[model samples]
Target: MPLVTSRRFFELGDTVWARWYSARKETWELGTIKEKVGSKMYKIFIIKYEATCIRHIDQLLKFTGNDNSLKINNTDNVESRNFQSLPLLPSMPVNAPLSEPSVSNLRSSTIVEQPVNTDAIDHGNGEEWGDYSAQDSVGDSTKIPEASDSPEASENGVEQP
Candidate 1:
C-alpha cells in the first residue's frame, strides 16, 4: 500500500497541545479536539484562551501524558517556571462520602457576658441623647405633606386664579 498523506489523526474530545503563532510570539497551548473539519483539519477548543479555532494536523500534538518536553509550562518565563513533574493526587475520591465530625471533637466554651462602659464614649456636646427604640423609628415614618387644593397664600395682594 502507498503512503497516505491526508489522514484523520485526532478524535473528538481528545486532549492536545496546539501550536499558536501570533505577530509577536509562537506558543503551544493545551486544548481538546472539538470537531473534524476535514480529513487533516480539525476545530479545537483552546483551554487557555477559552476560544475555538480550526487547526491543521501539523499544528496539533496528541497529549498522551508521556511527552514531558512538549507539555506547555503555563508561564511566559521559562527560567522561573517551577512546577511539580507529576500532578497532585487527592487522598480520597471527590464522590466519596464525607464522615460527620463527632460531638467529642467539638470544643465547648462558656460565653462570658462583659459589662458595657458608657463613660468611655465621648458625647460631642454635654447634652445626653435619649435612647431611640423601635417605636421611635416607626413614628419617624410620617405621611408626607401634599399640595393643598386651596389657592396659594401670597404675602403680596396679587392672587393667582
Candidate 2:
C-alpha cells in the first residue's frame, strides 16, 4: 500500500516532494513541500519547474530512497511518526564506522615565501583599482537612474522644466 492520504499530516520543515499542476503550463511538475497549509494542501517550492502552486496532500508523495513515494489518502489527521527526519546527507559521513583520518601520521613541509601578488598589476589608465580613494579611482561606473520627481513621468522626449 502507498503512504499517501488526505489524512497525511506534515509538520513544518518536513521535507516532501509533490506534483504541482499549472494552468498556464498544462503540465505537472515535481516540487518540495516547504509548508503545510490547511488539512489537505501544501505550499511547494519547485525549482526549475515552469510553475509552482499549492498542492493537495494526495498530490504529495514521500521521498523514498529512490526519490519517490506513493500518495494514497486524504483527511485532516494526526502527524506522522513513521517519517523521522534524518540529516540531509553530510558532505563527509560523521557516523560512518571508518576511523577519522589521522593527521599525526602524515608529513608536512613549512611553506616559507614572499607574498606573491597573482592579481593583475595595474599599469594605470585608472582601470585596475585597489586600495584607492573614490577620488583616485577612475572607470565607467554603472549608473542607475533615479525615479523622476515629476508627478507625470514621460517615456518620450518631452522635456519638463
Candidate 3:
C-alpha cells in the first residue's frame, strides 16, 4: 500500500476548514463540505453562518487542528503546512439546519479600509476636526443645504441678474 499524497480528503457532511475567497483576497473560514459538485469543485456552506460558496480541490487545504500535531481526523493533518490558525466550530453540527437572518434582523453595517487623515485639526474650543470613520461615525448632516440647481442662482443660491 502506497502513502496517499493528496493535500486534502473531504466528503459531504464533513466539517472542514476550507479556504474562501472574497473579492480578490483569501480567507480560511470554517465551513462544511455540503456536496462534491464534480471531480474537483465543492459546494461549501460558510459557518460565518451566512452565504454558500464553491471552491476547487487545490483551494481546499487540509485543516491541521492544533500545534500538538493531534488532528481531528486522519485526512486533516496530511497537508504540507500547519494550519493551527484555522477556526472551527466542532460543537456545531455539520448538517445543522440553517436559518438565514433577514436584513432587518442584521445590525447596521458599514465598509471600512478607507484612507484616514492623520492630520487632525484642533479648533481649541474643545473640538477636533478629522475624517469620520464608519465605526465612530460623525453625526448626520446638521442641516440640509438649500437647492441651487436653477441656472439663474447666484453664489449664495440667491437669484442673480
Strongest candidate by TM-score: 1
What TM-score would candidate 3 get against the native? Answer: 0.36
lDDT of each: 0.60, 0.48, 0.58
- TM values, all candidates: 0.39, 0.30, 0.36
Q: Tens-digit lDDT track for model 1 on 39-104?
A: 889999876566898999977766655434433445533333222222223752222112323456
Off by over 4 Å in 3: 1-8, 66-161
In order of listing, the candidates' clash counts read: 0, 9, 0
List the candidate numbers ranked by lDDT, top first: 1, 3, 2
Model 3, range 1-161, lDDT digits (tens) per residue?
99967554687866656666554435566567889998788998765645688988765644545434434343552253344545345653232212323456446658788785566654464445565443355456544344554555566668533
Q: What C-alpha lDDT, on a 0 to 100 scale, does residue 108 get in candidate 3?
A: 63
> Which of 2 and 3 is the better model by lDDT?
3
C-alpha RMSD by candidate, in order: 19.4, 20.5, 18.7
Alpha carbon lDDT at 123, candidate 1? 69
Clash pairs (backbone) in predicted model 1: none
Error of 1 at 57 (Å): 0.4
Off by over 4 Å in 1: 4-8, 66-161
